[model samples]
Target: MSFRSEPFLWIHLAGLAVLPLFLELTWLGLAIAESLVPVWLELILLAIVGIVPIAWMQWQKPFDIFSLLFVALQPQQLTSQQRQILRLFKTRKHRVLTLFAVLAMGWALWKLAVFAPLAAPAAARLTQSRGLGLGLAIVGFLGSNLFLQVPISVLGVLLTSNGQFEVTEPLTPEEVSQSVTVLGFRVGNILPTVASNNL
Candidate 1:
């Protein structure tokens, strides 16, 4: 089956990847509001923590990342071999492990971002203003999901396919032929009837 046909699976995987990030950001924002941290330092640290890994991944596997985005927009028709590779992800064990991996990675990153020497002060400041803290959390959550997590997940799927699928041209609908009905009615058969000169 094509990846597009499995909406539930994609949704599940996305939730697995982003929910932890949302919670982590919310907590970080709350913490930040409570501390006297340098906003510039916090922004710089966040940029380094988030962008560096993604940049490295993009550099290492440019094709995989591009293919992921392409496939996401126009899902490729899978070959039997490609389907076999995808089936592994559908298994209970793999599904559970994937969820765990995403969660573990998020947890590790959150700890790194919040507890690291320079970041610790910034994260501590999140709790000082509840409204601002939550606002930052919401914006961060949406931005990260849209720009970071989703692309990473797509890249993972493309890598799993192992370049087995081909990008086919888009399918177009064929023209329908006119036919006669059982009752002798001309269905979809348009014709001009000539009138007799005498009539």
Candidate 2:
């Protein structure tokens, strides 16, 4: 069925679009996407979904941090002091997340280097029939995208974090303001303070 024709499909697709928001700590969107689909198709679907956002997350350096800032600032909601604390928390959260990503990338790369070489061949064989292979291939692509592309990006983040390379700075005031406006539009008046801050 076409994506638009099926309500569930549309919902799932919409979920995918907002997946980045859920990447605050873990890759929640990717995890959700993985859970919704079959294990056989996980790799391919995940791979396709993985790359750009992961890159965006790492490049941005404070995706979740900014999210928290938006949360605290949006409400008037919180005192400026509270917003400052939230910003501190956001920075800490970013640090924790960065640590986890580094460890995960290291672990995954080790496993991939050891097992991926073998697994890919086996998966390729099981999917001998064109139709089955096509589906399996899609799953594989998603998996690779999720696993490899994301890890690669994380490695870039790791390097940047560790001082081996330079990384882009966090979003500027203008960008933050724009994002705040967008957030208010998406969420509503409870966050009017953040919307006002944007002005």
Provide backbone clash counts, one per model: 14, 17
Question: In model 1, what lDDT does residue 36 have?
Answer: 50
Q: Which candidate is the best by lDDT?
A: 1
- Per-residue lDDT of candidate 1, residues 66-167 (tens digit): 122223211132223323433333334433433444454455446644654444476664445745764665456444533444344443554544343343
Stretches off by above 4 angstroms in model 2 are 1-61, 64-86, 89-93, 96-100, 117-185, 189-199
What's the true lDDT of residue 196 in model 2? Answer: 54
Error of 2 at 75 (Å): 6.5
TM-score against truth, every candidate? 0.32, 0.31
Q: Native-vs-model 2 lDDT?
A: 0.34
Tell me, by TM-score, which candidate is best: 1
Model 1 misplaced stretches (Cα beyond 4 Å): 1-31, 35-76, 102-128, 138-199
